[model samples]
Target: MAHVVSAMASETSPEDLTDLSLEQLLNLEVISASRLGQKSSQAPTSVSILTANDIRTFGWRTLAEALNSMRGLFTSNDRNYSYLGIRGFMRGGDYNSRILLMIDGQRMNENIYDGGYIAQEFMLDMDLVERIEYIPGSGSSIYGANAFLGMINVVTKQGKAIDGSQLAGEIGTFDTYKGRVSYGKTLKNGTDLLFSASHYDTAGVENLYFPGYDSPETNNGIAHKMDDERADRLFGKIKFEELTLSGGYVDRGRHVPTAAFDGIFNDPLFFTDDKQFFSNLKYEKALNENTSLLLKGFYQGYDYYGDQAYIVNDARVINHDEASGRWWGGEAQLTTHPFEGHRLIAGLEYQYDQRQRLLNYDLDPYLPYLESHRNGHRVEVYLQDDIQLLDDLVFSAGARLDYHHMLKNLQLNPRVGLIWSPLTNTQFKLLYSSTFRAPNAWERDYNAFGFVDNPLMREEQIKSYEAIAEWRSDSNLRLLGTLFYNDISQLLEGHLTGDADGNYALINAGRFHAYGGELEAEKRWSNGRLLKASYTYSLLTNENRHGAWANASPQNLFKLHYAEPLFDNYLSLGLESIFIDSRKNGLGGKVNGYELVNINLSSDKLIHGLDTSFGIYNVFDSHYQMLGVSENIDVLRMNGREFRLKFQLTF
Candidate 1:
């Protein structure tokens, strides 16, 4: 399967460059390291750029949804939360602390359980996002700790992109509804300001299943319980000359059931309301024609709560928990062209995080409360040199040193890359890098059953390498192919001990190796028709004994998308299909493979002075699960196939 896809990708024409307006393409810069003065093709890592157009084409409503279509990205069925695993390493429910998420260069990873939580509930609204830059390799050298797997940087929309006022609304399966409004203006002082707000609500589907667990006498039966989610978000951005400032707030709530054992269980209501606020201040000043300084500072906070009820040992238990944290950081960057054909970038960064958590139970009123607090400080210095060794060749090397106050350890990471343009329209690049992950607060302090914290947890490390070949064709066809491998060591895993609680303690006792290849192609027809396709194949193996562990990585993944304009200047149609190979859940249980199909039709035409659009998700009603949780007896499902429709207007 991989060979076939590779052969087909190689046959694509090599003269095509992306067809985009200068402004639109420049907007992609927010996520493009090349645009950020990081050597583009020569960066020592694998990176994918998702432009605003890509987001619009997918009709995504959130950052999690927007990332769903990527070759290596997947979301849990719950939709409200998602995880990104590079190669084959990934964390379970507590993903935020394992992966680092950034907005406009500010760290958003909050000190939580064992790692930072993504705070998916409070992430910027999709309408406020301009681009997403995904680096799928160890970024600890440049990003630190939570960036063990990779880093995702979300760049918000600027006022210049908002041509006028806009409004949109959507309704879908399971009584789902969403609405959004955006406004932008240029002040007399030449400063650009933009504001956006959006809301989403859903009474979700009843497709979940609890094995051997059923209420034969009830109308709701054993089918998964009904779930619901609500979210409200607001964002604002101001740009004045070389400085840009942006921030946002979000309030989100969700109700979910707990994992059950057999037919006897408790139906729990899970609620999470997250409030986040962030601001970024950047200054770009040129000291000379060849030297420039970039300064950035950001602060973010997460006020989060999780409330739920569950049945344990045939006894009903209710849990009310609150977790809150604040994170702030600043960076200073200097870029200098000290010699011909060479560029140097050096930067220093510092970040501080603090969190407080409490858990109380109503059923066991006499039980003592659980309280936990954590503080972390990170400081890093990095330098990169991009040398144009030849007219068509570039060599780049970089290094970073990081200090973690909690661990009292210092780490040094290094990266190297080479790019060669053997042909005018073709480029071949090679990259290698080493990155590390620090333990999260929860991972180090939480004392829950089934899990334990280790203060002496060694950092997780990965040595990754990739080779890519890309070609552009005159016929508007572009092809890109990459082969990659990753060696992971010092992974944090729970070592089961015969303790009274049957819990496992955290230890550096796991190792994993993974290799994969990906092929992507896009073609543009003269009549404005576009076709895009991608395929990914990966193989992963665990070298440690934990449980009934097997290959957890999906073996095959594919995507196809087609888009065309219709009805003159008023309408567009997009068709998409996604496929995933069968894989094991976190518990190492196998799941059946599935495919999904989606269709979207939109119009920008004026209908009675209103700009409107409508879209349908999961058009084929394919039954699929986005996430699975494994316990002693059963596997719990989170998401299933559903439908959605949306409309918008402007006054």
Candidate 2:
């Protein structure tokens, strides 16, 4: 298989891209995740690339909005709380512990609770984002522990990418307002610096269906007051040849209304403030004509106050508390091509996390509070061979071995891929990979209301197989289809032990299977018009557990996007449609699914130094839910028909 793929790849020649638009850059190869410059189709897993043009066309305000349109990805809203589940397994807000987020190869997910706060929007200013590369599968082989669910790598804009300083702002319904300013400069010594700041505020829309309260004296009630939110953020980056450094800070505060309250209800307040700093240094020395040695190192720090809630029940009850923590880690990697068609990558990583709870209502009143801390060290080595057997086929295989100090366990992940190009414009690929997820801090030490910690938890593992076919016609039509199956073992399920205090401890249990398929097609017209569409269907079943079939796994997900030039290259119109099938919530109850439509009209013409845009989201005001957890406030309310008009000027 490897020989066939290598031969086919060598037979084909690269294309000339002088006429391709910026939007077409989505098809370019992604280099961040794999540390290898490989196209998404060649990867052994599901990968999605969102280009800068796509971001602008969609008018996405945050990373969440951009991800919502992707196939196989799901999102749910719960006021200041948000949840993301990929493939099938999903939990509510504070999911950073399971999924991993990286910025320019630096880990950003907080270590506490096994996750970071996803609802704290505005963590990354959209204006500064150059592009986003997403891989929806286990990344533990390369990223270590938190790469359980998948990886989202945010690629920021460099000073070289921007022409000069720019400023922009927007105002819309529900008292929503946003503003941003950025500057970029290049030094004489081939170095560059870029800085940006943005702010967003909103008086949230009314999402509740039922109006006022009913009393013994009357059955009539008034409409519930809608919750509101406000946020601010700052980001900066500097680049010097092979070395890049970046940092940012974000502060977000929001207030959410209770389900049963009008003016006399509970109002939960959430505040999250986080800081991120990281640097990447790389050096390359040529060993010979066909061999070279490359070295790289990265360090990152993330600190935040996550989901601190002040709960007021009825009139006499007052519950106030907060959870805070910090996570810091560093990685060093070395790569060498000692032989022709052979590549070797080796890395070592170390991470330490400390969590402190200042106040806990459930802890023993007399016992002294103990600050919980967890430190982890991981060392790994991996090697791969991309053999070029013939002019039309390519074969690649690799394996990774990692040692974890906390788990006292060693993991081995292996992957193999074969690419065969029978035709100049068509490719067929087969891939198989094994990956695993280490138990997070929360899964091991969480002892809260009705949830007990399990110290002897085992890591979860998955073996996946995938096949893909892609055809790119010379007439500007592209079609792609993929089929995949995953066998998962060591799934962690909570073991319930009913105690006097109604607390339940979690014990690892169960094995599962997940299978899915995706199809996508794109067409580009000669007149600068294009259409993109995709569909995904998946089934996730817990083979060991009875009556556990009705969870948040959608049977069908579909999307359609259209873009056309309205007036030469100065004006354009964009439309998008997203559809999701009905699925069950965490409690095994059915939830309705709906379709959403959005439209945007924008231009690249600069008036003075300003670039301008006008757009509308939820054009039809369709009501829908992104995600649903058990008994949690259902995030069913959709953003109403809203208009966002903005102008960005560059100096």
Candidate 3:
């Protein structure tokens, strides 16, 4: 667990948070919960923070792996993309539009599909990440859209933290290799500069077996030498005084071994490429003792291209699918103390989507199947107030209104929270909020060979209620609990229309309800020893049919993490365990439950300025499967075991 530090007025200069005692750290202050620095107990929602130390100790390879260790979240992969499951509600093959992702306070979701890429396709390398802030619950009242279930903000390290140049390299199982070079320095003129670049490639598994495709022509159920992937990333940042500029870019390509979407099996031509780029500029200034002003502008773009090999009239043809998007946005915010007990925050935002295009074609005959192009914009205004009614109690209320030209609709969302401190070390909170997600261009206008367009699709909505409690003891132990329920309506889902060719269409499902509870316990020692555990239970049902929802996540999840310093503080060991219950596969069949064990060993001071780590994932070699996208492959097998060794030197 990351130690909480004292609150500061400026958001960028948080170097103080790195140096704090255990007792002070227990009282954590989170920024994403309220868009400002505040104690966890006083914030409107429950917050979880993971620091760069955690990443190094646990040897987490990706953002998905780090987030899965949290209390009430899980992630699944379809071999093409990774999808996040929140509160036991997950739709297979989803693009992760329900969760909002940010990097240094800038949105990462693109304009066309609104997809939040979390795996290797993500723009930033894990080495540059300073910390991750997770605020679980609806945040549309502040962020406008795509904040239905959770808001994750990834904070990057400052130039002062690095202070030099660094080079790193890693080798992993399946012929995987990675290399990185970074430079950061703060000059005597009070200016800071940072830059980093990374490259990764992997041959993937030598062979993968799919029982559903167990035919002689499909290489006897085995796909060989077709799961290769490669990626490259570049990032940079500059800061001086009240102004900051930062940008990042990533390009990745992955081969599809499962032959999803009725592609030809054992074909190496089936693959997809994704490229994403974004740049942001921000300014912060203090107008007076009681008022502050902030401004930001950002531009982001995305491009996706895919090739699927299929047999048509006993001949192989490649289907080329392409999509591209470009968007730019600006925001202005003001924070002031209006009264003796009231703090007010107000902001306005506008976004212009310059390009949203999708197209599909064949290379041989050069036949164009589908072509769509469009542009749109959005405007939003939000305000929030936190009032201290008593010495130990606070009330918070906020709302936002958004107008979208594409949807031709206006939406308003609200949030309210009440917090009370009954004892010196105990606190309680009650929260209520509502959020919505508009259908993206992919769902509303994508008409392809195996899909139909639905231009009249509407937005989905959710209402959530939660109660939370926190208690801390003098023995360096902390416990937290939360109970919550959510009502969801008009969920967009792909439905089989019973056509002879098995064409699918996107439609809004009627209604759904989910209830869950989470419990977490953490203990820390003064000698660098730590123990943490958490359990989550959720039940999700379809209100329209009075039955369980299809492809929903497991009802129970348990996770544990432990770390200990060894060899006179020269080395450390980290261990973790994860258990996931069985889940339905949407085909009236169930995927069995499984558990995993991961271990890591690392040391930063053993060789002075040199850091090294060794990690083994899935030590027990557990066998498991996850729900797939198409009917041909209803379930996809998971990886069994892997190994990685990394070294970094700073000069």
For every model shown, what is its TM-score relative to the native structure? 0.88, 0.86, 0.96
Off by over 4 Å in 1: 1-46, 78-80, 113-122, 138-141, 206-209, 215-225, 260-268, 311-315, 356-366, 498-501, 525-528, 545-551, 586-588, 606-610, 632-641
Writing each residue's lDDT as its tens digit, candidate 2 over 1-651 gives 000000112222112222243224434555422433255555445567665667777677778778777767767675555667676666554464556676655566655455544444435777677667676663223444556666777767667556577888888787788888888878899788888888888876644442223343222321244466777777777767655566777777666443321223333433334444444454444556654444555544444443323223433332323355554555555545666665555555555443422333412222222234566565666666665556667776777777765466788887777778788677777777777767765567666546767778877777777788887776778788888777777867776677677766655575767788889888877765778898988787877765256366677889898988786767777898988787776664666887888888777774555567788888888767644332433334555688888777777
Give one digit per residue, the lDDT tens place, for model 1 in 262-337: 2223344555566667777777677899887777777777776766565567675666666777777777877788
Instruction: Summarize candidate 3's per-residue lDDT along 1-651 as a digit string, tens digits.
Output: 011122343443454344333355545566522443266556777777777777888898888888888888888888878888888988666578888888887889888778888899888999888777787764333566887787777788887778899999999999999999999999999899999999999999889888888889889889998888999999999999988899999999999999887899989899999999999888887899988777888888999999999999999999999999999989888878888998888888888989999998999978899899988888888888888889888888888888876566799988888889888788888888987888888788888878898777777889989898988888878899999898989998778979898998888875888899999998877766779899999988888777665355789999999989899878989898988888888777877877878999999888889999999999988767777666767778888899999999999
RMSD of 2: 5.1
Task: Name the lDDT value of residue 573 in candidate 3.
Answer: 92
- Per-candidate clashes come to 20, 26, 1
Pick out the ten consecutive residues of candidate 1 with the lowest summed lDDT: 1-10
**Cα deviation of 192, candidate 2, in Å:** 1.5
For residue 339, give model 1's deviation from the true position in Å: 1.7
> In candidate 3, which residue pairs clash?
4-25
TM-score of 3: 0.96
409: Cα error in model 1, Å: 1.6
For TM-score, the strongest prediction is 3
